[model samples]
Target chain A: MYCRQPLRTIETIDDLHYNLQLAVELEFSTLPTYLQALYSIKEGSNTIAYSVIRSVIMEEMFHLTNAANVLIATGGSPALNSPEFIPIYPTFLPDNEKWFEARLLKLSPQALMLFLAIEMPGDLVPISMITIGKFYENIEKGLKYLDEKMGADLFPCGTLDKQIEHKYYYGGGGIINKVTNLDSALFALNAIIAQGEGAPNKHWDPDKSFPLEDTTGIESGDHQLFMQPRELSHFYRFNELKKGRRYVLGDSHNSGPTGPEININYDDVYNLKPDPQSGDYIHYPELEEMNFNVNVIFSRLLDQLHLAFNGQPKTLETAVCTMFSLKEVIQILMRNPIPDNELGEYAAPTWEYLSPEERTLSSIR
Target chain B: MYRLDDFYDLSATLTDYPVTRLIGTGVGNEYNQTLSQWVRQDVLDELYHCFSQLERNNDGQVCPQALRHQLLSNEKYGPIARNIIKMWYLSIWYKMTDNWSMTYGIPAYSSPVIGVESPTPEDYIISNNAYIQGLVWPLMGSHPMGAKQPGYGTWSDAPLNSIASIHLQ
Candidate 1:
């Protein structure tokens, strides 16, 4: 649904709670897709990818906790375990069809594109487009509508208030009616994005295209194997084994999967090594897209963990260590496409194993 | 000029004292005399000069709008001005608390920002003028106060009362 008002202008604790709720919802929405992607990976070979996905999913739980704490600290009740909490993917939004799409479990270039589109909607445009891109807009509308119906402000408590008491009934503290404004809205969005993706383009600044060829290990001609403009370099690449296409040394012409030009030699990449037992190479329809999704989810989780500990030094150090361990696990996964039956080795460190010092100050709680 | 050590010592003393007792003693009588010396007229004058520049109108009271506007107006002085405004407000509250203690034999407790309609001993025990000031202190430049205004007022009144009530009590 399109928001009747802008979200960036939010000024109260209620607004913060609402926005946090939206964030939690979005993270939850991504869960099923990620889990489905994890399941789609080859049974044994996807161990590391599976671990990465699982760890991120678990950390998202921590994010929800932090959001809840902030909400409570501001005298708002955190709505968890609610019927509306679990999102039905590809659900139609009020804005437009392109804005919402059917959830697809299969991994492919199209799937990855869909995932990216969902994860990062287009700029917050006043004039709604076919895609009706901004997710925050929907939240803004929902909050405003609720406020009008209730006839009370949310987060009436000001910043100077000493203690935001948790009230059992709804009327104690005021509700926040407005969402943050576009600039501030973008700042919060970008803060999360930058922590995951690199920094976003600044105002009036020319987009500095980082050619796909510059990515570590991957060559330019290899770019043609996937899709191109190859100029959109900030996104994750899902280069998988394709049977027919020749691995080019330094070409950068491919654009996207469904576009007029398709450069991937699916047969060549996948068929190179066939399984002796099955007399076929291990292949899945959209392995590249799946790989990309896994990578993006893992990277984003690491970023989120980093953000959780942003200001608190002790927590930051612990988070960094955890992140380092996660990175190590990812590296192992990258090297070994599939591991032996065991999965625990590749998984993130369990809470039990965390040092006492680390455990005491964890922001995860 | 007030030395950092003196400031730290005053802070330490304030930190240890009971919140209610501190409020009643007023600014001068409660804390160590050594620390109080630095906070006297000289410091107040310097603070007043800073406050005058920050106050948007000639009004003596520093309203949220005025504080927000002044601190956010310029790049060079914004952060420092904001911090000083916070510190000044806190210092006044602290002094008032001591005054309350001296004027009234009973401790004048600070009120809780939310839920409480009147002052209570719990409020006095828990409140810290400087710490609360540090929490709401604004950052540099003309950023919108946005959602912070209401909370600021609610919390600001607690200290304001702890200071002002001393005379009446």
Candidate 2:
């Protein structure tokens, strides 16, 4: 057992931008896997497990936005369209690269356990170690140090429009805000930590008083939800699902959710094969076609998001529409069984990025 | 003889919807059940066997023209194909015309038919679930009333495609 050395924090603006981009990719990497589990549920059978995974994925999207905003606020472009942005399946999440691998599997005991590990709270980590929470903490320190050293021009002027504010995103339960300056940027980091791995308290939403207004309204003038009791942060939500229970108001992180029992039948899930790839379906042309279709839309979404982060913020509305359209194809993939697999599993979208030559229907055919 | 895959392939030709999109509607299996219960077993088998012949033309691609000539225009299988399309788009399965039924009908008419205007029992909305998932919703760039709503402000966007474009290589 050797002593662990402290990992280097972001020391420059370039360092900050690079690390934040990694944060964006890191946050994004979990989505396909988590959504696979969410969509795998036979409709209305595992409603409890379904919603838990759904909420977690929503928060992960919010985290991606925050990371992109921080990268943009530091005068850096969010590079997302390249193939490198999408990590190969069964790959390690940057935080867990050294020890564990994340996979694309349907909701089962294994997937839930993987989620628990991915969102494991920093408080649970040994000191002098690097977890995702520690990664963010280092970014927080880097922001402070750089803001002091660089003085007034740290975050450049006229880049404020690049940040995705509350006006851009809407709907169910992810904290949306802008990152304009040091305070707002730091607040973004705090929200990521507080909601994801738990704040130092291990069970509190940072800035508890932050107002979440009517998600549908163009701007706030109606139905502002204030001081709603904190929902389970990511780590604890998975824990509750794994424990087959709920976390009540007074429960601590380690309390293991002693509320009313929740039931999820593992048999109700679609049998998604672990870590499917585009090449895996050469024998299954229609599955390949469906899989390719998913990649086209998925790639388009990444391009649209990149555009939204860099300059064209209004594109987000269209982006949201594009995101919703993905459900149909993914559902089709999940519901159909893989034709001849020995495991009798279903096909799933591999979340691969299509090259420009492969993007067009005619071109690929 | 009663394979869902053949039924899906057959349905794709009749409905002009991708097999994937057809399944995505969450009623393909139900539509298959509707076919089994309403149509004669031999007729269903005859219709599905056409897909096996699909391997002959266009290098194994699904050709609407061939299906139209062989099944859609056939006196025996034609009406069945038409009803399959209706069941998918409108969630209602129409009984064969009196002459066709007299010639080739099964006697398993389950009650709870939604169409009461005709003197004889005519058709049914398969289920409330089926009606809500009707292909009409996606076709019209809208959703069934009080179900699967895109959300609050989806109306402003351009109409999304009813079917994702399919490419076979």
User: Could you tell me which residue pairs clash in candidate 2?
Assistant: none
Per-residue error at B121 for model 2, in Å? 6.0
The stretch of ten residues in a row with the least summed lDDT in candidate 1 chain B is B135-144
**Number of the top-ranking candidate, with DockQ as the measure:** 2
Q: What is the TM-score of chain A alone in each candidate?
A: 0.40, 0.89
User: With candidate 1 superimposed using the best TM-score fit, by how many Å does residue B32's alpha carbon deviate from the native?
Assistant: 86
Residue range A1-365, candidate 2, lDDT tens digits: 01122447767887777778778888998998899899899877888787778777877887888889888888988888888888888977754434567899899999989998788776676765567787788888899999999976678887878788777655435556677789988878777776677554455543243222222111121222222334556787788789997766455654556667889899988888889988888888778888888899898888888898889887777777678768766887777777778989888999977777888877545
> How does chain B score by TM in each prediction?
0.22, 0.78
Which CAPRI tier for candidate 1? incorrect
lDDT of 1 by residue, A143-194 (tens): 4554555443443344212221122112111121122233323333333332
Cα error of candidate 2 at position B111, Å: 10
Q: Where in model 1 is the C-alpha error above 4 Å?
A: A1-12, A45-73, A92-98, A102-104, A121-189, A195-207, A211-214, A217-365, B1-169
Best of the candidates, TM-score: 2
> CA lDDT of B151 in candidate 1?
26
